[model samples]
Target: MKLNQFLRTALVACAAVFTIGVSLSTQAPTVSASSATYKTVATTSIKKAPYHKKSSAGAIYNASHTKKVANLKTYPYTTWYATAKVTLKHGSSKALYYKVKNASGSVSGIVWNKYVTPGKSPFGLKYAKSAVALDVNTNNNVWTKNPNTARPIASLSKLMTLYLVRQKIAQGKGTWSSKVNTSNAGLKRLGKSNVFGGFKFNHNSYTVRQLYLAGLIESSNNAAIALGQWVAGGSTPAYNKKFIGMMNNQASEWHLKHSSFVSASGMEQNSLQPYGYSIGASKNANYVSASDIAQISRHFIVDYNDILTDASVKSMKVDGQTLHNYNNLLPGRKYYQKSLKVDGLKTGYTDPAGYCFVGTGRKSGHDRIVTVVLHDENEFTETRSLMNYVYNQNLA
Candidate 1:
């Protein structure tokens, strides 16, 4: 079958199938978005449908449980998108199929797949699975899956820690030159065999600025604990509690419902090993959505850049061992040399969380864009691909 012809037939077939199940209100779920209307079909049949790629832009889709499923008791009348829109070729056609299963044992809804033509914005393509893209310059938000779904933030939690520290510094309670000692207990807690295994610090003495540099630049866990301890008077737990409170306070102040924090370090409990310690467990760590990340980035870019100054940003060295900034895309060509206005940002990863980044960059005099990728498998490739898509297609 010709691609376009096949797509038309598939769309018609899906529509017919969805129409039959529309009256099965208890079984056939209805999903409504500002941009489109969706009807649910059988959940088991989604994997059987074939999908054709119509564009070079990336796409993602996942069959995970909808966030609504968890809150059905509270929001009984809610709707869910069974199949999200993927980009298509102009004047060409493609179709994908999806099944939407309810919390109960039965199939509740089916998604009649439709394809969207690529937009003018290069970065406007749909990401497969649960993904979202935003252009702060135009207030343009595009998402597949639940864009506002809150998930563990991993090391991205450090941005908030840095923010609070900066706040204290601004209030004259602290300064960049302020020195803080690292305790044996703090070192022991941070010395767990993970990212911090390479650091060989004295564990007895370090300045606030020194620890801050290590925490933000190299993402040293000990540095993070040390800074938190210093802030809360040599108690990591107390400091962590206050730090989380600060995060909640910021969330409330910013009207962010999907933001929460439980630890300064994003560690959580390990499910695989009942006794194993997991760094940034899904249950006990910080959580935030893509939009929340954008909001926080805006605060950093527009409001708090002064705090993360070039001097302080560059001042990250541990015991005279200078740590190279992991933000490889920052204003240098070693990673993506030449004409890239990429500046400082944070990167995070964990087994449960996958790879995540909250990156910011600019193109000449064009609008500054913040690109965030969460729960990505190959974060480096994904980040470069997204950035290339934005620079070549969207921002250019």
Candidate 2:
């Protein structure tokens, strides 16, 4: 009897220990953001929690779970970088929430018990004055800041020009081998200081393919205008208008709401006010939102795989002249991000737009990503940083 009793007690003690261990293993930790613990934890950008708001911020989600704003609760503790502190009226006790001011301006919302993580904003989004980042396959907006605000896009305009030229060629409206005569404007553009990737009027006429490549590779204003004229039936005023109309029509077809095109070369031109906001001056330029530019990049890659495949050409041999590709993000080039599998895309810049880039890259175990940056002096830096954050966060 004594032996049996002892065995029973031993078994009970062992079971108790086992239960305690299991309980410890199952429980998650609670730590503040400022706790030296932040370094140990994997930190990323601000993210919408996987969970949904059971009730809107203003609505009372409280200890008692009542509708009264006073009934809303407040958390006793908060971690650093967890949630932005906007002054919003909350309940007297628990589940307190406040207003959050987004880039658009002041806004009202509830910050629940577990909404935003408190800590340093690791994404460096403050540097992105106007930008959009997304996944190509899902078409999801992974991250954006002032994405709808339109701003001038310099040579990035050439992407559309390239697309149109290819479309015309595909439809039998234009041919690569067809001889396109350089206009007097094209000739006069030579030796002008404003011209980029320009040649010195060496040839009277260039093949359609040569002109198109010149614009794409070298970002030559002269080549782009020449191609535009060719598309417009020889660069006449009426013909140019017809071509410009086509560009607008294409933007519409793509459902681009904020993008407007005035010139094929992405040179500065007057833009219309999509939103009536003025410091008493016009917001005119080749305006396009980061979101619109990102979509364009996604569509360009999906629709024309050849652009990615053929973007490897560093320079195009046009008769005797060599026009170089300006995209430094390409493989084996300077400013290349090894982690970012960037094959092809375009870059842009102007006085108003600063520097812009439409970048595409593939991350491991993920689909392609399209990133657009505007109004940054170092476009390359902004693009690379954003790409790194997106891939690391796995937001898509």
Candidate 3:
């Protein structure tokens, strides 16, 4: 018989046993009606002799082997086959139908379907009231809370400073190897109470690339002031104009309207007054939204990979110290998995800005996620929590 027909018959027999319990009267159905086609022949069965005989070779001889020929009758044993037909319903129509049965008639070894539910985010940051996440590769927005609200970006604005430097480099206005002389005025500006303490001396001579690296990976205000002065032709007004222009240009390109840039460094001189100190400004600081920072990060990953790939940006060593990328996620830690494929990014912190980070990582085959946290009280904990949440929800 064909395989399908055999399975159908077996399923029917098994279904009968399952529905009404197995019985001897439920014999397997015959497919053919003609007795000649399914003929039974007479056969003889041999009987065994009595035990307790040994061979000449010293091996014991069994009863059947030593028994004499004798006439015997043969009979076929009874067997039952049952098959079951199952129908799966979808709405008002039957979706799928199949037959199943027990091969041994015991129904104990039969296989069945197993169901499982999908997993959710594991980091447990879903309760956060304000969070923004975007996948740069897919441009998918995954936000748990308020994502568009304006917030201080802190040193994250240095990304724009680096962007402006790259812009100048692309325009042939500046070269990576170009040397920048730090003056007394520039050092004083960067050494202000609100600025970096590293910028104390006027004799510090660094290349454009080194300054950019310091500003980007180390958040060095001195380097930012130097670059800003270089871009402004050693004039504060000139540099501020170009800085704001570049910021607006980037904002427009990235479709970020809620963000603005007022300084190369993001430091607000003081909160009590409208005017604050920046790289060159003695006024209020720059501001940007979390979304804009994410967009800028995407641009760096896509359009400006060369900036990060440059030898100067990669292996920048100055003052007997080698500068590394500020992104802590590049080298995966014990608490963070290396499988997340996280690369270089930026981090920011200020009294007014709190702690902020723009992190990016690729997942699966096509999923690439970017997370931005702004004005976080506990940045270390919140950053890890948000990163874990996005990785689990979007990548895992």
Candidate 4:
């Protein structure tokens, strides 16, 4: 989310990448009793045909005929009021298209036949250059301007740091209450060039809890390195090597084919070479597909919720110096959304990753969605826009 991890005066650290860019429910949310309900009256070339939502549409385009359309996670039978066999822009083969209103009863739009039937949306990390949004529970159900592409994930890699540390705690290897000092190796990372969210590494010692919180909350670079060292067997280079392996192992365990991690904190490996650390041959920052990132967040929802709740801390006293979360959407903050039940996941940024956010929120307490925005110019606003589209459908 920022270069200097130790302190944050504001959440405006990542340079915006905004271009533009969810499933989520089947029933059309009814707003008022007076809203119109049409009893199908077939006439002309029109006929009512019901169709099931495709289990996976890799993406939902706006117009369904060409550009982008908002996608919902809902998969109930949709009543198509009209259908027409037409040629579309995406390909040369002519196919049937439907103008259907989903069960949610929000306004209707054009939908291609394949997405509603036995066929599914196209797949891959296809469109990740501009942005990507995903439904946490569904397979291959996502929206992206560019999927099937590899992109930098910046500080989002800290999610792995969060996961691994919590894994150790769950294993009784360490506890949040454990005490750990800022290793000389960590302190040396304080002024490394190209590192972000910088904070002065003044204190030599802090509770294990403090350093852990700094990595997730403030995205403190040194705090992440310090925690890596601590868990890597008492701040030794050899152990840290093993720790990095653990991170990759976790990714492999998740079957994230397009994802790779060279560091625990998501900083580019070569960028840190001046500080005497090399991340082996790739010399890259962490990389993850938008879909895998969504799944990673879903894993957070299922396994590491304590980290999520702690991450929702808009402000916390870390060693008595308050640090603010970079995710501005957390409730009670100036940028929070009143309509959406906003909590948190994480945020990331770097020159290569552009401005990225792995944002999560829900409404009515259960329909959680994890959205990944990569290479965005306006990470926060664009993320809010995508979340709004999902919630606005009244699917939840």
Q: Which candidate is the best by TM-score?
A: 4
In Å, residue 154's CA in model 4 sits off its true spot by 0.6
Model 2, runs deviating above 4 Å: 1-121, 190-197, 270-284
Candidate 1 ranges beyond 4 A from true positions: 1-145, 192-201, 233-236, 269-282, 306-316, 331-337, 388-396
- TM-score for each candidate, following the candidate numbering: 0.60, 0.64, 0.59, 0.66
Residue 86 of model 1 has an lDDT of 27
| lDDT of every model, 2 decimals | 0.50, 0.58, 0.50, 0.61
Ranking by lDDT: 4, 2, 1, 3
Write candidate 3's Cα lDDT for 1-396 as tens digits: 000000011111111111123221222112223211211121222231111111111111112112112110000010112122222221222211112111222211111111101121123332323456777766666654457766777778878777777777789987999777665464555544353534343455678876776777566765775676676566344555565666767788778877777666676645312222333444466667777777787777676875434312333555555555545555543224465556556677766676677766664453666678776644434545555445533332
Encode model 4's per-residue lDDT on 22-62: one tens digit a residue: 12112221213342332222212455555545543412333
Give residue 53's error in model 3 in angstroms. Answer: 73
Model 3 TM-score?
A: 0.59
Worst 10 residues of 1 by lDDT: 1-10
A best-first ranking of the candidates according to their TM-score comes to: 4, 2, 1, 3
lDDT of 1 by residue, 1-396 (tens): 000000111211111222332123212222323213332323332222223223322122233212122211211112223333322111122233343322221223323233212222222223312344456567455333355878776777777677666667778888888877755554654555554433445656776777776767766665665566566555445555565666678778888788887656555444212212233434565678867776776676666765335422533456767665656555442344344466657777666666677666666645666667677654444455455445443333
Q: Provide the lDDT at 243 for model 1.
A: 54
